[model samples]
Target chain A: MEPYPYTVNPFVHQDRFWYPFVSPFDPCPPIRAKRYVVPPNQFLGFQPPNLLQFPPAQALMKGTLWPALFSPYKKTGKVEIKDP
Target chain B: MWVYEKKLQYPVRVSQCNPTLAKYLIEQYGGADGELAAALRYLNQRYTLPDKVTGLLTDIGTEEFAHLEMIATMVYKLTKDATPEQLKEAGLGDHYADHDRALFYHNAAGNPFTATYIQAKGDPIADLYEDIAAEEKARATYQWLIDISDDPDINDGLKFLREREVVHSQRFREAVELIKEYNEQKNFF
Candidate 1:
Protein backbone atom coordinates (compact mmCIF):
# COMPACT_ATOMS: atom_id res chain seq x y z
CA MET A 1 0.00 0.00 0.00
CA GLU A 2 1.20 3.48 -0.84
CA PRO A 3 1.89 5.66 2.20
CA TYR A 4 0.26 9.08 2.20
CA PRO A 5 -1.10 7.93 -1.17
CA TYR A 6 -3.19 10.99 -1.88
CA THR A 7 -1.34 13.82 -3.67
CA VAL A 8 -1.29 16.73 -1.18
CA ASN A 9 -1.07 20.40 -1.94
CA PRO A 10 0.65 19.92 -5.30
CA PHE A 11 -1.24 22.93 -6.56
CA VAL A 12 0.13 25.14 -3.78
CA HIS A 13 2.27 27.80 -5.47
CA GLN A 14 6.03 28.24 -5.09
CA ASP A 15 6.62 31.27 -7.33
CA ARG A 16 5.27 34.70 -6.53
CA PHE A 17 5.13 37.81 -8.73
CA TRP A 18 6.25 41.06 -7.14
CA TYR A 19 5.00 44.06 -9.10
CA PRO A 20 7.20 47.03 -8.42
CA PHE A 21 5.57 50.42 -8.66
CA VAL A 22 6.93 52.24 -11.73
CA SER A 23 8.08 55.74 -10.85
CA PRO A 24 7.54 58.57 -13.32
CA PHE A 25 11.11 59.82 -12.88
CA ASP A 26 12.61 56.37 -13.22
CA PRO A 27 15.44 56.02 -15.71
CA CYS A 28 14.38 52.58 -16.92
CA PRO A 29 11.03 51.45 -18.31
CA PRO A 30 8.39 49.97 -16.05
CA ILE A 31 9.11 46.32 -15.35
CA ARG A 32 6.06 44.49 -14.09
CA ALA A 33 5.63 41.00 -12.74
CA LYS A 34 9.18 40.24 -11.65
CA ARG A 35 8.78 36.58 -10.76
CA TYR A 36 10.29 35.43 -7.49
CA VAL A 37 10.11 32.22 -5.54
CA VAL A 38 8.57 31.57 -2.17
CA PRO A 39 10.31 28.25 -1.63
CA PRO A 40 8.59 25.30 0.06
CA ASN A 41 10.46 25.82 3.34
CA GLN A 42 8.99 29.30 3.77
CA PHE A 43 5.48 27.88 3.45
CA LEU A 44 6.50 25.33 6.02
CA GLY A 45 7.94 27.35 8.92
CA PHE A 46 8.90 23.98 10.23
CA GLN A 47 8.34 20.65 8.52
CA PRO A 48 4.78 19.70 9.42
CA PRO A 49 3.60 16.32 10.69
CA ASN A 50 2.52 13.51 8.40
CA LEU A 51 3.77 15.12 5.21
CA LEU A 52 2.90 13.40 1.94
CA GLN A 53 5.87 11.65 0.38
CA PHE A 54 6.87 10.63 -3.13
CA PRO A 55 7.45 6.94 -3.87
CA PRO A 56 11.02 5.69 -3.59
CA ALA A 57 11.74 5.90 -7.33
CA GLN A 58 10.01 9.27 -7.65
CA ALA A 59 11.73 10.50 -4.49
CA LEU A 60 15.20 9.73 -5.84
CA MET A 61 14.34 11.34 -9.16
CA LYS A 62 12.82 14.45 -7.54
CA GLY A 63 15.83 14.96 -5.19
CA THR A 64 13.62 14.76 -2.09
CA LEU A 65 11.36 12.34 -0.19
CA TRP A 66 8.65 14.91 0.52
CA PRO A 67 6.65 16.04 -2.49
CA ALA A 68 6.16 19.49 -0.92
CA LEU A 69 9.88 20.11 -0.99
CA PHE A 70 10.47 19.26 -4.65
CA SER A 71 10.80 22.63 -6.36
CA PRO A 72 11.77 22.39 -10.04
CA TYR A 73 13.61 25.52 -11.08
CA LYS A 74 13.45 27.32 -14.44
CA LYS A 75 16.33 29.60 -15.33
CA THR A 76 15.58 33.26 -15.80
CA GLY A 77 17.51 34.53 -18.85
CA LYS A 78 17.98 34.46 -22.64
CA VAL A 79 17.26 30.81 -23.25
CA GLU A 80 13.62 29.90 -22.67
CA ILE A 81 13.24 26.28 -21.63
CA LYS A 82 9.85 25.14 -20.42
CA ASP A 83 9.30 25.51 -16.68
CA PRO A 84 7.99 22.53 -14.71
CA MET B 1 33.44 5.91 8.94
CA TRP B 2 31.68 5.98 5.54
CA VAL B 3 31.19 3.01 3.28
CA TYR B 4 31.98 3.48 -0.39
CA GLU B 5 28.86 3.57 -2.53
CA LYS B 6 29.77 2.44 -6.03
CA LYS B 7 26.68 3.80 -7.70
CA LEU B 8 26.19 7.55 -8.08
CA GLN B 9 23.37 9.04 -5.94
CA TYR B 10 21.87 10.10 -9.22
CA PRO B 11 22.84 8.63 -12.56
CA VAL B 12 25.16 10.82 -14.67
CA ARG B 13 25.16 9.87 -18.34
CA VAL B 14 26.83 12.37 -20.67
CA SER B 15 25.52 12.47 -24.25
CA GLN B 16 28.44 14.38 -25.77
CA CYS B 17 31.99 15.25 -24.79
CA ASN B 18 32.05 19.03 -24.43
CA PRO B 19 35.16 20.34 -22.71
CA THR B 20 33.59 23.80 -22.46
CA LEU B 21 30.79 22.37 -20.41
CA ALA B 22 33.36 20.51 -18.38
CA LYS B 23 35.10 23.79 -17.59
CA TYR B 24 31.85 25.33 -16.38
CA LEU B 25 31.03 22.21 -14.37
CA ILE B 26 34.28 22.50 -12.40
CA GLU B 27 32.97 25.66 -10.75
CA GLN B 28 30.46 23.52 -8.86
CA TYR B 29 33.09 20.83 -8.33
CA GLY B 30 35.58 23.19 -6.62
CA GLY B 31 34.21 26.73 -6.49
CA ALA B 32 33.17 28.65 -3.35
CA ASP B 33 29.60 27.36 -3.28
CA GLY B 34 30.58 23.93 -4.59
CA GLU B 35 29.84 20.57 -3.03
CA LEU B 36 33.28 20.19 -1.40
CA ALA B 37 32.86 23.43 0.48
CA ALA B 38 29.36 22.43 1.48
CA ALA B 39 30.44 18.98 2.72
CA LEU B 40 33.35 20.28 4.76
CA ARG B 41 31.42 23.19 6.20
CA TYR B 42 28.49 21.12 7.42
CA LEU B 43 30.59 18.23 8.70
CA ASN B 44 32.84 20.56 10.64
CA GLN B 45 29.86 22.36 12.11
CA ARG B 46 28.24 19.11 13.20
CA TYR B 47 30.65 18.55 16.08
CA THR B 48 29.83 21.85 17.80
CA LEU B 49 26.09 21.97 17.07
CA PRO B 50 23.41 20.92 19.55
CA ASP B 51 23.02 17.13 19.56
CA LYS B 52 19.55 17.15 18.02
CA VAL B 53 20.62 18.75 14.73
CA THR B 54 24.09 17.23 14.66
CA GLY B 55 22.77 14.21 12.85
CA LEU B 56 21.15 16.42 10.23
CA LEU B 57 24.44 18.09 9.46
CA THR B 58 26.24 14.76 9.19
CA ASP B 59 23.56 13.36 6.91
CA ILE B 60 23.55 16.38 4.59
CA GLY B 61 27.33 16.65 4.61
CA THR B 62 27.61 13.02 3.55
CA GLU B 63 25.02 13.63 0.85
CA GLU B 64 27.07 16.55 -0.49
CA PHE B 65 29.95 14.15 -1.09
CA ALA B 66 27.61 12.07 -3.20
CA HIS B 67 26.75 15.24 -5.08
CA LEU B 68 30.45 15.94 -5.47
CA GLU B 69 30.97 12.46 -6.91
CA MET B 70 28.11 12.94 -9.32
CA ILE B 71 29.69 16.19 -10.56
CA ALA B 72 33.10 14.55 -10.94
CA THR B 73 31.48 11.82 -13.01
CA MET B 74 29.95 14.40 -15.34
CA VAL B 75 33.20 16.31 -15.72
CA TYR B 76 35.18 13.13 -16.32
CA LYS B 77 32.75 11.78 -18.91
CA LEU B 78 32.60 15.12 -20.70
CA THR B 79 36.35 15.65 -21.02
CA LYS B 80 37.68 12.08 -21.11
CA ASP B 81 37.54 11.73 -24.89
CA ALA B 82 38.51 15.28 -25.92
CA THR B 83 41.82 15.70 -27.73
CA PRO B 84 44.47 18.12 -26.38
CA GLU B 85 43.61 20.59 -29.11
CA GLN B 86 39.94 20.25 -28.37
CA LEU B 87 40.52 20.97 -24.70
CA LYS B 88 42.55 24.06 -25.64
CA GLU B 89 39.80 25.30 -27.95
CA ALA B 90 37.35 25.06 -25.07
CA GLY B 91 39.45 27.59 -23.04
CA LEU B 92 41.17 24.91 -20.95
CA GLY B 93 44.60 25.39 -22.55
CA ASP B 94 46.09 26.61 -19.29
CA HIS B 95 44.49 23.69 -17.45
CA TYR B 96 45.64 21.20 -20.10
CA ALA B 97 49.20 22.46 -19.93
CA ASP B 98 49.27 21.89 -16.18
CA HIS B 99 46.98 18.90 -15.50
CA ASP B 100 46.44 17.18 -18.88
CA ARG B 101 42.89 15.80 -18.33
CA ALA B 102 43.52 15.19 -14.63
CA LEU B 103 40.99 16.98 -12.39
CA PHE B 104 42.30 19.89 -10.34
CA TYR B 105 40.41 21.80 -7.67
CA HIS B 106 39.81 25.10 -9.43
CA ASN B 107 36.94 27.38 -10.29
CA ALA B 108 35.76 28.46 -13.75
CA ALA B 109 38.02 31.52 -13.45
CA GLY B 110 41.01 29.24 -12.58
CA ASN B 111 41.13 30.22 -8.89
CA PRO B 112 42.23 27.26 -6.79
CA PHE B 113 39.90 26.01 -4.09
CA THR B 114 40.88 27.27 -0.65
CA ALA B 115 39.86 26.91 3.01
CA THR B 116 38.31 30.38 2.83
CA TYR B 117 35.47 28.82 0.81
CA ILE B 118 34.16 26.96 3.89
CA GLN B 119 33.51 28.29 7.39
CA ALA B 120 32.65 26.56 10.66
CA LYS B 121 31.59 29.27 13.06
CA GLY B 122 30.52 28.13 16.55
CA ASP B 123 27.30 30.08 16.35
CA PRO B 124 24.45 27.94 15.03
CA ILE B 125 22.43 30.82 13.59
CA ALA B 126 25.44 32.18 11.74
CA ASP B 127 26.45 28.79 10.39
CA LEU B 128 22.91 27.86 9.40
CA TYR B 129 22.43 31.18 7.61
CA GLU B 130 25.74 30.70 5.80
CA ASP B 131 24.56 27.24 4.79
CA ILE B 132 21.25 28.67 3.59
CA ALA B 133 23.05 31.28 1.49
CA ALA B 134 25.43 28.71 0.08
CA GLU B 135 22.56 26.51 -1.04
CA GLU B 136 20.84 29.44 -2.76
CA LYS B 137 24.04 30.46 -4.48
CA ALA B 138 24.68 26.92 -5.68
CA ARG B 139 21.11 26.75 -6.92
CA ALA B 140 21.67 29.90 -8.96
CA THR B 141 24.97 28.60 -10.31
CA TYR B 142 23.30 25.41 -11.49
CA GLN B 143 20.57 27.47 -13.11
CA TRP B 144 23.08 29.50 -15.08
CA LEU B 145 25.06 26.40 -16.05
CA ILE B 146 21.87 24.76 -17.24
CA ASP B 147 21.00 27.91 -19.17
CA ILE B 148 24.22 27.92 -21.23
CA SER B 149 24.56 24.19 -21.84
CA ASP B 150 22.67 22.53 -24.69
CA ASP B 151 23.37 18.91 -23.83
CA PRO B 152 20.21 17.29 -22.51
CA ASP B 153 21.97 14.61 -20.47
CA ILE B 154 24.23 17.09 -18.69
CA ASN B 155 21.21 19.26 -18.03
CA ASP B 156 19.41 16.31 -16.52
CA GLY B 157 22.24 15.92 -14.03
CA LEU B 158 22.37 19.67 -13.43
CA LYS B 159 18.61 19.78 -12.86
CA PHE B 160 18.87 17.06 -10.24
CA LEU B 161 21.70 18.93 -8.55
CA ARG B 162 19.72 22.16 -8.65
CA GLU B 163 16.69 20.60 -6.99
CA ARG B 164 18.88 19.14 -4.28
CA GLU B 165 19.89 22.66 -3.37
CA VAL B 166 16.26 23.47 -2.74
CA VAL B 167 15.95 20.50 -0.41
CA HIS B 168 19.16 21.39 1.45
CA SER B 169 18.17 25.00 1.85
CA GLN B 170 14.81 23.97 3.25
CA ARG B 171 16.42 21.65 5.74
CA PHE B 172 18.84 24.29 6.90
CA ARG B 173 16.02 26.73 7.47
CA GLU B 174 14.19 24.15 9.53
CA ALA B 175 17.38 23.44 11.44
CA VAL B 176 17.63 27.10 12.31
CA GLU B 177 14.14 26.94 13.73
CA LEU B 178 15.02 23.82 15.65
CA ILE B 179 18.08 25.46 17.16
CA LYS B 180 16.06 28.51 18.15
CA GLU B 181 13.52 26.34 19.93
CA TYR B 182 16.35 24.55 21.73
CA ASN B 183 17.81 27.88 22.83
CA GLU B 184 14.44 28.86 24.25
CA GLN B 185 14.32 25.64 26.25
CA LYS B 186 17.83 26.24 27.57
CA ASN B 187 16.78 29.76 28.63
CA PHE B 188 13.94 28.29 30.69
CA PHE B 189 16.35 26.62 33.10
Candidate 2:
Protein backbone atom coordinates (compact mmCIF):
# COMPACT_ATOMS: atom_id res chain seq x y z
CA MET A 1 0.00 0.00 0.00
CA GLU A 2 1.27 3.46 -0.85
CA PRO A 3 1.67 5.72 2.12
CA TYR A 4 -0.15 9.05 2.33
CA PRO A 5 1.93 11.78 0.74
CA TYR A 6 2.69 14.65 3.10
CA THR A 7 5.22 17.44 3.05
CA VAL A 8 6.90 18.46 6.27
CA ASN A 9 7.29 22.08 7.38
CA PRO A 10 10.66 22.72 9.01
CA PHE A 11 9.51 25.83 10.87
CA VAL A 12 7.99 26.33 14.29
CA HIS A 13 5.67 29.29 14.99
CA GLN A 14 5.29 30.93 18.34
CA ASP A 15 2.46 33.30 19.24
CA ARG A 16 4.29 34.85 22.19
CA PHE A 17 5.42 38.43 21.68
CA TRP A 18 8.57 37.90 23.76
CA TYR A 19 9.88 34.87 21.80
CA PRO A 20 10.85 34.69 18.17
CA PHE A 21 7.70 34.32 16.07
CA VAL A 22 9.19 32.03 13.39
CA SER A 23 12.07 29.61 13.79
CA PRO A 24 13.65 27.63 10.90
CA PHE A 25 15.18 24.15 11.33
CA ASP A 26 18.55 24.76 9.69
CA PRO A 27 21.03 23.87 12.47
CA CYS A 28 24.06 25.51 10.83
CA PRO A 29 22.84 28.64 9.13
CA PRO A 30 25.25 30.15 6.63
CA ILE A 31 27.11 33.08 8.14
CA ARG A 32 27.86 36.25 6.16
CA ALA A 33 31.45 36.40 4.87
CA LYS A 34 32.21 39.63 6.69
CA ARG A 35 30.51 38.36 9.85
CA TYR A 36 32.66 35.21 9.84
CA VAL A 37 35.79 36.95 11.05
CA VAL A 38 37.70 35.24 13.85
CA PRO A 39 38.25 36.89 17.23
CA PRO A 40 41.65 38.25 18.34
CA ASN A 41 43.89 35.64 19.94
CA GLN A 42 44.34 36.25 23.67
CA PHE A 43 47.52 34.13 23.73
CA LEU A 44 45.95 31.62 26.10
CA GLY A 45 47.97 28.51 26.92
CA PHE A 46 47.67 25.67 24.37
CA GLN A 47 47.31 23.02 27.05
CA PRO A 48 43.94 22.32 28.65
CA PRO A 49 43.25 24.07 31.97
CA ASN A 50 44.20 21.68 34.80
CA LEU A 51 42.46 23.33 37.76
CA LEU A 52 43.03 20.41 40.11
CA GLN A 53 46.61 19.87 41.26
CA PHE A 54 46.92 16.10 41.66
CA PRO A 55 50.14 14.25 42.44
CA PRO A 56 52.30 13.38 39.41
CA ALA A 57 52.21 9.63 40.23
CA GLN A 58 48.42 9.44 40.66
CA ALA A 59 46.72 8.12 37.55
CA LEU A 60 43.17 9.35 36.97
CA MET A 61 40.70 6.48 36.69
CA LYS A 62 37.11 7.06 35.51
CA GLY A 63 34.11 4.72 35.44
CA THR A 64 33.64 1.30 37.06
CA LEU A 65 34.32 -0.76 33.89
CA TRP A 66 38.12 -0.29 34.15
CA PRO A 67 38.17 -1.17 37.85
CA ALA A 68 36.13 -4.30 37.06
CA LEU A 69 38.70 -5.33 34.43
CA PHE A 70 41.79 -4.77 36.63
CA SER A 71 42.65 -2.94 39.85
CA PRO A 72 46.19 -1.58 40.30
CA TYR A 73 45.71 -1.10 44.05
CA LYS A 74 45.21 -4.56 45.51
CA LYS A 75 43.95 -5.37 49.02
CA THR A 76 46.59 -8.12 49.53
CA GLY A 77 49.39 -5.77 48.26
CA LYS A 78 50.73 -8.56 46.05
CA VAL A 79 51.12 -6.77 42.69
CA GLU A 80 51.22 -3.07 43.62
CA ILE A 81 53.60 -0.99 41.47
CA LYS A 82 56.00 0.59 43.95
CA ASP A 83 57.63 3.87 42.90
CA PRO A 84 61.24 3.84 44.14
CA MET B 1 33.87 11.58 39.02
CA TRP B 2 34.19 14.67 36.77
CA VAL B 3 37.08 17.15 36.86
CA TYR B 4 36.33 20.88 36.91
CA GLU B 5 37.51 22.88 33.92
CA LYS B 6 37.77 26.64 34.33
CA LYS B 7 37.21 27.26 30.61
CA LEU B 8 34.23 26.86 28.30
CA GLN B 9 34.26 24.50 25.29
CA TYR B 10 33.52 27.55 23.13
CA PRO B 11 34.10 31.16 24.16
CA VAL B 12 30.92 33.20 24.85
CA ARG B 13 31.36 36.97 25.01
CA VAL B 14 28.25 39.07 24.66
CA SER B 15 29.35 42.68 24.04
CA GLN B 16 25.80 44.03 23.90
CA CYS B 17 23.13 43.40 26.50
CA ASN B 18 20.02 42.14 24.76
CA PRO B 19 17.56 41.02 27.35
CA THR B 20 15.10 39.90 24.67
CA LEU B 21 17.58 37.57 23.09
CA ALA B 22 18.65 36.35 26.50
CA LYS B 23 15.06 35.29 27.23
CA TYR B 24 14.90 33.28 24.03
CA LEU B 25 18.34 31.71 24.51
CA ILE B 26 17.24 30.48 27.93
CA GLU B 27 15.26 27.77 26.13
CA GLN B 28 18.47 26.12 24.92
CA TYR B 29 19.92 26.51 28.40
CA GLY B 30 17.17 24.53 30.19
CA GLY B 31 14.53 23.64 27.62
CA ALA B 32 13.20 20.13 26.90
CA ASP B 33 15.95 19.39 24.36
CA GLY B 34 18.56 21.54 26.16
CA GLU B 35 22.16 20.58 26.99
CA LEU B 36 21.33 19.84 30.61
CA ALA B 37 18.73 17.28 29.53
CA ALA B 38 21.10 15.78 26.95
CA ALA B 39 23.92 15.41 29.50
CA LEU B 40 21.69 13.75 32.10
CA ARG B 41 19.96 11.48 29.56
CA TYR B 42 23.21 10.09 28.12
CA LEU B 43 24.96 9.75 31.49
CA ASN B 44 22.01 7.92 33.06
CA GLN B 45 21.58 5.59 30.04
CA ARG B 46 25.26 4.61 30.04
CA TYR B 47 24.88 2.33 33.06
CA THR B 48 22.77 -0.21 31.13
CA LEU B 49 24.80 -0.02 27.89
CA PRO B 50 27.74 -2.23 26.85
CA ASP B 51 31.29 -1.17 27.71
CA LYS B 52 32.21 0.73 24.52
CA VAL B 53 28.80 2.35 24.18
CA THR B 54 28.97 3.32 27.86
CA GLY B 55 32.29 5.05 27.19
CA LEU B 56 30.83 6.93 24.20
CA LEU B 57 27.84 8.12 26.20
CA THR B 58 30.09 9.16 29.10
CA ASP B 59 32.35 11.26 26.88
CA ILE B 60 29.47 12.86 24.94
CA GLY B 61 27.60 13.52 28.17
CA THR B 62 30.65 15.25 29.58
CA GLU B 63 30.87 17.41 26.46
CA GLU B 64 27.21 18.28 26.83
CA PHE B 65 28.00 19.56 30.32
CA ALA B 66 30.53 21.97 28.80
CA HIS B 67 27.94 23.11 26.26
CA LEU B 68 25.53 23.76 29.12
CA GLU B 69 28.15 25.91 30.79
CA MET B 70 28.68 27.89 27.59
CA ILE B 71 24.95 28.57 27.22
CA ALA B 72 24.69 29.64 30.85
CA THR B 73 27.66 31.96 30.42
CA MET B 74 26.09 33.61 27.40
CA VAL B 75 22.83 34.11 29.25
CA TYR B 76 24.66 35.60 32.22
CA LYS B 77 26.62 38.03 30.06
CA LEU B 78 23.49 39.13 28.21
CA THR B 79 21.59 39.92 31.36
CA LYS B 80 24.47 41.19 33.47
CA ASP B 81 24.14 44.94 32.93
CA ALA B 82 20.53 45.03 31.77
CA THR B 83 18.45 47.61 33.62
CA PRO B 84 15.06 46.70 35.11
CA GLU B 85 13.38 49.04 32.64
CA GLN B 86 15.19 47.43 29.72
CA LEU B 87 14.29 43.97 30.94
CA LYS B 88 10.64 44.98 31.35
CA GLU B 89 10.66 46.47 27.87
CA ALA B 90 12.07 43.22 26.57
CA GLY B 91 9.15 41.29 28.09
CA LEU B 92 11.47 39.75 30.68
CA GLY B 93 9.70 41.43 33.58
CA ASP B 94 8.32 38.19 34.97
CA HIS B 95 11.69 36.44 34.80
CA TYR B 96 13.45 39.43 36.34
CA ALA B 97 10.85 39.54 39.05
CA ASP B 98 11.54 35.92 39.90
CA HIS B 99 15.32 35.65 39.69
CA ASP B 100 16.59 39.19 39.00
CA ARG B 101 19.75 39.21 36.83
CA ALA B 102 20.79 35.74 37.95
CA LEU B 103 20.48 32.70 35.66
CA PHE B 104 17.75 30.18 36.49
CA TYR B 105 17.09 26.77 34.93
CA HIS B 106 14.00 27.30 32.78
CA ASN B 107 12.73 27.21 29.22
CA ALA B 108 11.72 30.21 27.10
CA ALA B 109 8.20 30.09 28.46
CA GLY B 110 9.67 29.92 31.99
CA ASN B 111 8.95 26.24 32.74
CA PRO B 112 11.51 24.71 35.11
CA PHE B 113 13.63 21.78 33.90
CA THR B 114 12.45 18.30 34.89
CA ALA B 115 13.82 14.76 34.56
CA THR B 116 10.85 13.84 32.32
CA TYR B 117 12.56 15.76 29.44
CA ILE B 118 14.47 12.57 28.56
CA GLN B 119 14.02 8.82 29.00
CA ALA B 120 16.75 6.30 29.84
CA LYS B 121 15.34 3.11 28.35
CA GLY B 122 17.33 0.00 29.31
CA ASP B 123 17.28 -1.24 25.70
CA PRO B 124 20.37 -0.14 23.80
CA ILE B 125 18.65 0.29 20.44
CA ALA B 126 15.81 2.29 21.94
CA ASP B 127 18.20 4.48 23.92
CA LEU B 128 20.41 5.18 20.90
CA TYR B 129 17.42 6.09 18.76
CA GLU B 130 16.25 8.47 21.48
CA ASP B 131 19.70 10.01 21.67
CA ILE B 132 19.73 10.63 17.92
CA ALA B 133 16.35 12.32 18.06
CA ALA B 134 17.48 14.35 21.05
CA GLU B 135 20.52 15.60 19.13
CA GLU B 136 18.41 16.57 16.10
CA LYS B 137 15.94 18.43 18.31
CA ALA B 138 18.76 20.30 20.01
CA ARG B 139 20.28 21.14 16.62
CA ALA B 140 16.96 22.51 15.42
CA THR B 141 16.63 24.66 18.53
CA TYR B 142 20.14 26.03 18.04
CA GLN B 143 19.28 26.86 14.44
CA TRP B 144 16.32 28.85 15.55
CA LEU B 145 18.51 30.67 18.04
CA ILE B 146 21.14 31.44 15.42
CA ASP B 147 18.51 32.72 13.04
CA ILE B 148 17.35 35.30 15.57
CA SER B 149 20.78 36.31 16.89
CA ASP B 150 22.88 39.03 15.15
CA ASP B 151 25.86 39.18 17.51
CA PRO B 152 28.98 37.56 16.04
CA ASP B 153 30.23 36.17 19.34
CA ILE B 154 26.91 34.53 20.22
CA ASN B 155 26.52 33.19 16.71
CA ASP B 156 29.97 31.62 16.76
CA GLY B 157 29.26 29.80 20.02
CA LEU B 158 25.88 28.63 18.72
CA LYS B 159 27.46 27.42 15.49
CA PHE B 160 30.03 25.31 17.39
CA LEU B 161 27.30 23.78 19.56
CA ARG B 162 25.03 23.10 16.57
CA GLU B 163 27.84 21.28 14.79
CA ARG B 164 28.54 19.25 17.91
CA GLU B 165 24.90 18.09 17.92
CA VAL B 166 25.27 16.85 14.36
CA VAL B 167 28.46 14.95 15.28
CA HIS B 168 26.78 13.41 18.33
CA SER B 169 23.89 12.25 16.14
CA GLN B 170 26.30 10.54 13.75
CA ARG B 171 28.08 8.79 16.64
CA PHE B 172 24.75 7.64 18.10
CA ARG B 173 23.81 6.17 14.71
CA GLU B 174 27.06 4.17 14.75
CA ALA B 175 26.26 2.96 18.27
CA VAL B 176 22.87 1.78 17.01
CA GLU B 177 24.60 -0.23 14.28
CA LEU B 178 26.95 -1.79 16.83
CA ILE B 179 23.98 -2.87 18.96
CA LYS B 180 22.28 -4.41 15.90
CA GLU B 181 25.41 -6.43 15.07
CA TYR B 182 25.66 -7.62 18.67
CA ASN B 183 22.02 -8.68 18.65
CA GLU B 184 22.43 -10.52 15.37
CA GLN B 185 25.39 -12.46 16.69
CA LYS B 186 23.55 -13.29 19.93
CA ASN B 187 20.51 -14.64 18.03
CA PHE B 188 22.69 -16.79 15.75
CA PHE B 189 23.80 -18.87 18.74
Best by TM-score: 1
lDDT of 1 by residue, B56-101 (tens): 9999999999999999999999999999999999999999999999
* Residue A84 accuracy (lDDT) in model 2: 16
lDDT per residue, candidate 2, B1-189, as tens digits? 989979876667785899899999999888999999999999999999877688999999999999899899998888889899999998899988988898888899999999999997798888888998998788778867877887777876786677677557767877776676655355654
Clash counts per candidate, in order, are 0, 0
Best by DockQ: 1
Task: Give, for candidate 1 chain A, the lowest lDDT window spanning 10 residues.
Answer: A75-84
TM-score of chain B of each: 0.96, 0.95
Estimate the TM-score of every prediction.
0.85, 0.68
User: What's the true lDDT of residue A4 in model 2?
Assistant: 16
Return the TM-scores of chain A for each candidate in numbered order. Answer: 0.57, 0.13
Q: Per-residue lDDT tens digits of candidate 1, residues A4-84? A: 235645335555455577789999876554665556765666778898989999888878889777777665553232222
